[model samples]
Structure formats: C-alpha cells, structure tokens
Target: MKIVSSEGQFQGINHNRAMEPAHQPVYEMVTRTRTRTRTIAAGLVVANLALSGLLSKADNYNGNNTPPADGGYRAEACESAKQYHYEHAGFNAPGNTGGGNSRADVNTDTNWFRFPVNFQVHMLSTNKIGATTLYKAQMDQLDVTNSNNGAIMGLDPSTNSTGATAVQTNPAGWFIESFFNLNLRQSLDGGHTYTPQPTHVVLTNHNPPVFAMAPLLPPLGGRYGGETNSKIFFCTNFSSPCCTNGIIITNVIHTGFSTNFPPPPRGSNAVHTFSSTVSFNISMDNGLSFSAASAPAVVTVSVAHRTNDLFDPDTGRTTMVLDTEMTQLDISGGTLPAGVKLRQSPAMPSDGITTILSNGPSSYMISSSFNIMPELSLDNGSTWIPTCICKRMKHIPPPDYPSTCLSNAPLGFWRLNELSGTTAFNSGSLGPTANGTDTSIVQGDPGANLTGMGANNFAYSFNTTAFVDINSSSLNLNTVTVAAWVRIPTGFLSAIVSRGTNSWRLYIDNGGHAVFQTGQGGAAASTAPVDDAQWHMLAGVYTSSTFIEQIFVDGVLAGPISSATVPGNPTIHTQIGAAPDGSQARFFGDIAQVAVFNQALTAAQIQTLRTAAGGPPSSPTPVLTISPGLGTSFDITCFFGTTVQRTYSLSSSPNWTTIGSNASPYILTVTPTTNAAFFRLVR
Candidate 1:
C-alpha cells in the first residue's frame, strides 16, 4: 500500500508480510545441554563448599536467583521476532501560531503486528523517535528517538500484514514553512525498519497537524481497484505565515496501492521507486470534505474527572481544580460522504473524536470531545440520532453501605495486614490461618492505599518457603472467582493459589504468563506477562453455566478461554503462594487483597471489585476479637453476615481440622490435650 498527499510532495508504501527468522533446533538443544551442565557444576561446587562451612553468598541459589526446575530459559526467539530498531530523524520547531507559542507534547501510536504482539511508536517535539527507550526482557536498552514533531502513524487496517505509514512536519524550513513541509515514511516489515519517501506539501502554514487513516470498508466505497485503499484524514490549524490563525482545516486523502512495483532497496529513494496515486479534498469548513461535523452543542453524560493542582507561591498553598470529562462523543450533526456512517463511539474517554463506520453507505458514529453524546447517522448524515454505547452502573457498596449488596459478597478475604501477627485474618466470615514463617507483610501500592480499606495498606511477601493455608469446607464451590493484587519482581514458575488436591490452581509459569487451571480440563494461559514488577489485579473465574474458565489481568481478559469443569464439592484445603501439597515451587512476590467469591462474578462485578479495592480506603475496619470465655475456653466474636468456621490444635505446630460453622458470637471450648491449645476462625 502507498499513500501520497494531494500535491504529490509526501508519499508512503506498505510492504507485504515477511517471516521473521526462528532459532535452529540444534542451537536450542545445545544451549539447553550447556545450561544443564553449568547448573550441575554449580550445584556440586556449592555442595562441596557447604561441607567445608565456607559457602560463598554467590553460591547460594535456592532463593530468588534459583534456576527453573526444568532449566534456565530465555525468550530469545520471541523477543527477536518482536524487536525493532529505531532511529531519530531530527527535530523541527513549529512555526509561530497566532495563539502564542506551541508547546511540545509527546504523542504515541501503536499497531498490532498480531494480537498481543504489537509495537508502540512514540514521538516528541524534541525530534526523537521512540521517545521512551525500548528495553528488552533482559534489560538491554535499544537506541532510538523521535524522528519528527507533530508526527502521526497509521496501519493498513485491511490486511494482517505489517504495513504502516507515518507522517511528520518537515524540519527544512522549506516553502510554506513547517506546516506545508510534510514528510512521509513507510514500514513494510512490521515496523522493524522504515524507508523514507519524498516530502509532500499539503498547504502553506498549518499548525497542530493531526492525521488518522483507516481502510475503506465495502459500505464506504471501493478501494482503487485493489484490495487495499486507505482513506487518510489530516487536520491542522490554518494560517498564512503558519501559526497566525486557528481556523481548523482538514484534508481527506484517498490512497490507492499497486503491487506492480516492488519495494525499493533499503536506503533507496522511496518516492522515486514507489507506485501509487493519491486524491484528496481540502475542507476549511471543519471536516466537511470527508465527513460532516456534529452540531457543537449536544447533551452528554459525565463519565470521569481529571484533577489538577495550581500552586499559590504567595500563600504557600495549593488549590485543587477538577474538570468533568465526557465519556461519549457528541456527534449530533456528524456525517460522512456518500457511503460512510458512524457506528460506535470510542471505547475510552481519552480517545478524542472517535469515528466508526458501518457496512451501509452513509452510516457512521462520530464522537468529539465537546459533544454531549455520540451521534449516529444512518442515512449518510441526512439524519442524526443520539446513542449511548456504555451505560454507567451504580457504584458498589453505595455511599450508604446498604445491606442489599450481599449477593456479591466474597467468601474469603485477606487484608494481609502487617500489624497482625503471622496470621492473615479473613475480613469475611472465614477463620484465620497460620501464615508461613518465610512470609512477611510489607507496604502495598500507594495508589491502592485507600484509607479505610485495610488490605490495601499492606501486602504479603512470600519467599520460596512461604505459604498460607486455609482449611474450610465452604471453599468447595463449583462456580468460583479468585482474585488478588500482585506484584512479582522476577518471573518464576510458582502457584499463586492452589487447592491441596489440585482441583484448581492459579499460577505463573516460567514464561511469566498467568495461568488458570481446573483439574477437570486444560489450563488457560494469559497472552501477556504479569511479572513486570508492576501492581496488577489477577483473577481466575470458573462458571458452571458455561463450564468455561477465564483468566483476567488488570480487569481485562488476557487469554483464550478454556472448557473446564470445577469439582462440585472440592474438599481440599487452599494454599496461597505454594502448591496444595506444599511440595512444589512457591511464589516469591507480593500479594494483597486476596479474595474468593463463591459465585462466578460477571465482568462488571469483577471490575467493581477491583475499583473498590483500589479506591480510597473505607472507614473503621470491622475487628475480630477473641477473649477468655471461661477457664481453658475462649469466645471469638465478630460482626459478619456470612458463615464462619473454626480450627484448633493443642500445640504450636497444630494439626488443623475444620470445626462446625457458627455465628458471630460463637464460643469455643478448648480441652488441652497437650501443654497448650490454639484456635482461629475463617470465612
């Protein structure tokens, strides 16, 4: 595919797909053998030094640095396949607009090489490409910078191939100043590399240039006798000497591609070698050329808020300012040429002025920042109707904390409090359990530290030997949801939570992918890695209705779903950070706000749970109190609406056995079979 401006000054081409090289089987085998040999040698050396009581700290590998049980492996092939080297093109300052000075802003655009395998290119006014340094999994930094200011990139939406085009302002101070001097580049190799094309002039003196492109669907009209013809939209502030006036002018450029011309050799002049034609229409009437703009005044629902603080140096104080933001675009008067009509609004509020086209000619959805709501036009902008794609749901736990919300109550919840002893109390009705010795609670993510939410204040850190066990019959449910806020600094194979009998397991594999497993079927693995030392909400859901298991990362579905039936009555005990049998590997990271819901939660409910857990802390936490009921007996009491179970043993190293369920003011009669006895409750 190739694109050029109306004046023929800018041009770009798309390269067909090319397979990335893969590692040889022999090389992989040899590497594995070598790693094994080294591991054995290191083990022997450490064993010998240990016998002499002279073991070096470097020789101790049983902790965080321990190699994987199978072998030490790196994703060299996958990393290479997705890697791309970038170069800086050189910066060009914008012309002075009548609106004063133009401030530099960092902008980013991304395209999927494939689902879950995509690259994001960033541009900065500083004239650097790849504004943020790209780092490999092994922490090696790649050299790249922004190539131009006010740069915009677009991918050919018609094909799955890695064909993309980019446009930027020229830095040469050529005819018509910076605005008219538009440059273009094309990447046929999935953004791995780029070939520059001849510069194109769109108009004289334009500021705040913006560009967007999409494949022309059937309803929007046919491509230029080819499978790929993309419509490009460019917008900018028009002025005589550049930056003199703010009249918004837009251009709709239609590009046609021809396969008759092969890609030019690297470093060759792309404009001279490429074969393509461009037709465009200029609209000084604010996007009326390609599409009609919605009326300026429309009704919209406020979805979120953006807050900023202004510092008062004189008073040594700061005043907070808030701006109400619209979630849907108002496109009351939106219209697109003969064949195109808007269909849906942007998926997110931050997405400014999203336009989606449908199959019928003249059907389109246009959302603008100032519009009250997204406007949909079915008859090619001849008519407009208000539409609401996303409906706001009521906030959970409503401000008044009504008792009617118990249906979504959690079966088990651990705040992972550092203030508490080596026992993680269940905020729910479940009883507490003895936490592993190698576990410690530390400060949690500050963004999640809501004042009233006790669990958000701290998180439990597990060494290789750490785990927490809760023995409860109520945990055996067919439909269940397990969720937690976790941060893993290093990727390792370890179970985050598992049942003793392997009925279910939520774990991270050596590849750093999150997996959800039910013994009845195969495990589901997320496409994205969650062990990047960043706080993420991980959830595994099993619903009996569909017999399907799902894994979610940060409230979004991460991977393919799996057909898995959970045991109706799984009696096995639960373990966190270790296998159910306490024999397999253990998790080495921070976990907080672990919750288990007996019922499979809907997507919205899961999102609500995440929002609530991360929201501002709530008021006074409910306390669990234990006091002497009578001699050698104790009374445990807590206000809870769910079932609570108790476990007791006669020694410090207690053999926990689940007791009968009881209400909040239950009394436990302890008969000491040994020197001392202990008791705890869990929901």
Candidate 2:
C-alpha cells in the first residue's frame, strides 16, 4: 500500500490537504511534556531546560505559535508585520496556521527569532451588541497594529468547532482553563530541583483561547492533569465568557503519536529547532526617545523552521505545497532589518505603536505569567542558566492610555471596552464575565469616541446605587490583585471593586483617599487625596506568601499594609463600582479596565497597567508654545479646550504673579525680567 515515488511535486502536496508523500520515509512527529530535556528528533534526546511550551518556540525550535484560537485574525499573502507585537493578542501573517494534520511553514514567524506582543482582554458580562462594539466573539478580523494584509495559520480542520461549524467538528473545555495562566518551573540544577510553582491556566477570550497547547506545542508546565480526578482537560466548552459561541474556532486537535518532534529538522544550518534571545534599543533621555535597536548582547543563532506539503486524493497523491509555519525572522549580528520603530505616532493616536517605551538605555527583562514561581535567573547571554526575565513596567505617555488594558498573563482582566450591552468582556486568560446589567450602570457614554477617549475608552457610568458583578471561581485563592481606572469627584469611601466588605474591597475612603480592604482587620488607605474630579488608576494587591497587602494610585505605592492577611473570598460574587450585592456603600463614579488575579502582581506590572489607563487625568503634559507678543510682552499659548474642565491659567515669576485664567490664544503684555521672563501655564 506504500509503493510510490518521491519526485517533482510528488503526489501528496496540497495546502488544503496537508499530507506527506507516500513513498518518502515520513518524518514522524514527536510531542511529550519535556522538562529539563527535549528531543531534537525521533529517539534523539538532548539536555538543557528547553522551556518547552513555556515562553517562545516549540521544542524542535519552530517559529510557529499560531493556534486555532488566533487563526481567526489571520490574513493572507503578507510578508512584513506592521509591528513586532501589537499590545493586543493578534497578528496577520500568511494563511491560517497550518495546524492539525500537519505542522508546515506557511508564513512561519519572521520577526527575528524574537516575538513581543502582550495580550489585553475586556470582560463583557453583557452581550456586546452595539454597532461600534468590537464584536470580539464574532470577530473574523480587525485592524491589528498596522497589518491586515498578512495571513495566519490556524488549527487543523480535523478537530471541528462545535459552536459555529458543527458540520464536521468538535470543540472542547480545555480552552477556558488554559487561558487562565501558565508558569515555567525551571530546574537549572539538572532536574535535581525545580521552582515550586503551580500554574492555573486561564486561556480566555472568544474561541480558540490559546495557540500553544498540546498539538500546537507541548505544554510548557508539562501535560497538566485536572485537579479533581487527575486527568488532562481536552474539550471545547462554550459556557464561559469570551469563550462563548463565535467565528473564532476552538479546534480540539487530536494528538496521540509522538513519532518525532513537532518541527522536523529541515535545513542545512538548522542545528536545533528553537532560538531564544532578548534584544534592546537605546533610549538616552529617560524614555522620550531611543536610538536604533541592536542585539549586541543577545546570544542566539537562527535556525530554519518546519515546512509543510499538501495532499491530493484525486490523483491518489497531492501536488500542492505550502509553508504553514510562522517563519522566524532573519537575524544579522543580533539585529534584524526592520522592527525598530512601528506604527507612526500619527497613525494610532490612542496607544500608538511608537518606539517611545520600546527602547531603554539599559537592558530590559520580560517575564510572562506574573506572581508565579519562576522568579530567579542568571541571564548573561553566556551560560544558559535559568534566568528570571524581569523589567519595570513601561511608562505610558502622559494624558493617554493604551488602546486596551495591560494584561501580562493575569488570572482575570476586564478591559470594559464594550460600547453597549450589559457585559464588558474579560480580556485576561480567565473566561469570566464582568456583568454591568444594573440599571444604574449606564453604557455608551456621550462623546465616547472623543472626550471620553482615554478616561473612558467606553467606560461604564455608575450612579449612586449602581454596581457590577463578576462570575468566576478564578479569584477564589490567596494572594490577589484588584485594580481599576476610576473617576470619583466626591470623597466617599465607596467600593470601586469588592466582594462585600467581609472579603476584599478596593474603594475610596472618607476623604477621597484610595483604600484596599483585605478584611475586617486588614485594610490599607492612601495618605493623600486621590479623588479630585479626574480619572485615576487604583490597584489593590495581597501576597499570601508574605501576608502583605498594598495600595497603589496611578502605579505609585501610596500605602502598604504589612502583615495583613486577606480573608477568604466571600460567597458573594465580585462587583465593580459598588459593594458586593450592591446593598451598601454604593459608588457614584466612572470605572473602566477592572483586572483581577489570583496571584499578587508585582509593583511594576500594576504600575504598567495603571500608566496604560492614562495614569492620573489631572496630570497632563500639554504642549505650550511661546512667541513674540505686541512689543515687550511675549505670547505664551497652551491648549485650552472649550470644555468646562481643564481651563488654562497664565502665571509669571517676578515674584510669581498670577494673571488669572484665560482662554486659548490669550496674549499677555508684560516686560522681561532681563530680556524675557519665564511664564508658565497651569490648568
């Protein structure tokens, strides 16, 4: 039955039908939960923690990471990526990731061996059904950072989706939990010991939650077995938020044989499959600007990824070949041709893909799935020792926030970007919804696309008696993080996010001070006033390991409650903009981007998320221009919107005399202290 020929366009080769030739000895695929050791090929084992299914590439080192969960956004016939990594978890390369039956080289990753893109999610408790709503669940494709002309390979059709296309498919429940969180427990000491870390994966967001699981890539933390009966989850359940029925598919790939590793060695220079490195760009003036990036310190050698051929049943063989893999970027002395600067600043006003925060005068370490056990590492680009990649959260541009929330692999994160509906989708891995069905909580605020751009980003307005609730068991553990972007004009100690006063709560105190309540006897309040009629980010974090709770305002440590243990999560569900059950301490404010995590997020992660939410609306770095006035006086002009808030005021120093508030283009007549006196505008 296997007598055939392997020649030009050998019978088995079609993009649609991914199958190998019958004559040639097929390179068997191998897949196993490898820890300190990995297999290069069939029966070929190698040492060193490959970090398989952990961070970057697959074991054999293929650049393919696209899974069915990510294939819906796939484009076609594209070469270069608009940006290295869009803040949101999306991309467009060639065709869909040629997953399932074959691991081929479609448009295999090509942005160097390095890929950088964080995922952002907004929990939509209500069905997002507005004209302007992102329609995440029904998403086919939208504008990524810049590219929409590219393509992406998705899961093999062998595993049909049960929701949208049940014709010849079947989805499962593994998508939800895998999206929750993932951590790599390293054992640099030759597997003698490993990091004492436990991972609770939350692969949230529409269908096909994650692209790197099982057949996509061996589980990084190992083939996880369910907690209850000790069995690996392998089904596509559509009951959870984001994981609801949609266009995005949740292909339950079938895997049993590990004949060989995922990416078979294909090229002459391909030593091992994976290539890992960290590159950097030089920023001189703090974070204002940066020089071109150079990977002088990066220690890695590029390798060829897996390639895919097609199958044809008509001729008893196939004749079409396709590169189903997301090929790796070509590197030259650590630096690649493109990816220094992305998406012109003018292109994307809100959360533009600029080089502003991408560059640093120093090296930056990045760690995924925060608050996990993998913390320490010896990253020197020399010895491949277990190194914990850590870095201070990037400082966001003042007066603006990221288009979405900063979700560095959290248990749950609700961006609350839904324009209309009773639901704000949780963008984190957690598949829970943040329901705002309360009558007092109003959606679709006025001028949502303009004035409410940053502060709101389609935020929900909570009236005096309104509140929102969350449905999920992800937050039922010790060491938690609760953060949100809020604007409360009045100083009332109301709950911004709480599960009733008995459990934990993040709210405002008697004097506009931000507070984080751990329990009846443990609560931390900010010293200074934070409610000044503007939007501010409030974060509450409790570390069970240390039994400490902290409060942060606009990403700064406002107060820390040492030796404070968080009480057990109450039976009541989590709520936003009001107290749990909304029976007491109702809130009157605007809230957006609510993030909850089972593990305590680092100060930097919280700070990054805060800065991404416009920091403090009051502190804006408005541009001021000064020119020659009538004769002696100089005309100093700054932006003064006609809006009632943020009026402009002119003040000068001879003794610092105030010239009173005025409209934009106001000219003042004053002589110079020497030739010119410094005039400042305060709003």
- The model with the greatest TM-score is 2
* C-alpha root-mean-square deviation, each candidate: 30.4, 27.5
Q: For model 2, how does the per-residue alpha-carbon lDDT over 224-311 read when each residue is reduced to its tens digit?
A: 1111111111112312111211111011111121221233233222222332222333332322443443332111112222232223
- Which lDDT value does model 2 have at 636? 47
Off by over 4 Å in 2: 1-406, 432-436, 446-456, 581-584, 614-683
lDDT of 1 by residue, 499-518 (tens): 74347778898989998877
In order of appearance, the predictions have TM-scores of: 0.33, 0.36
Task: Tally clashing residue pairs in candidate 2.
Answer: 87
